[model samples]
Target: MKKQELIHLHGLLAQVQNHYEEETGNDVEHDEYASVSVRPTSIHMSKDDHKDAVFALAAGITSELADEATEQVPAAAD
Candidate 1:
């Protein structure tokens, strides 16, 4: 993907994180992402930096969702 496209995706993921937190009243634990200290608006940063941030952020968000999914009980079909 182009650098601009990657940055756009990064921004979208950040918005997803914010929306999830707002709805659930819980924070997305993106420790690795935080360590990178790269924001979507960090246009001065390299493409690789944004790529790393995107992966870390996506992993954190998906991990949380996966955990939540596991706690639910699916209905049995007749």
Candidate 2:
């Protein structure tokens, strides 16, 4: 992919991650009724797995971008 396209994709991925974080954030101020509660532990592969997947995907994309950038750079002669 072109540099510009890679940059745009990276930006888009960042936005998506930011939005997901916001959505999953604990907006205490927005809560009308606040109460102390303990988080439940479950054997579900939904939340953490999903975030891990996104991070893995982003890392892969970033690696690809770096590879592309290096390919575009001319190697120096010894």
Most accurate candidate by TM-score: 1
Q: Highest lDDT, which number?
A: 1
What tens digits encode model 2's per-residue C-alpha lDDT throughout 8-69? Answer: 44456656545644775622121211121111122233444334434454664455456556
Model 1: weakest 10-residue lDDT segment is: 65-74
Q: Report the C-alpha lDDT of model 1 over 2-77, residue by residue, as the tens digit.
A: 8999999999999999999999987888799999899999999999999999999999999988887789687999
lDDT (Cα) of model 2:
0.42
TM-score of every candidate relative to the true structure? 0.89, 0.36
lDDT of 2 at 40: 19
- Extract clashing residue pairs from model 1: none
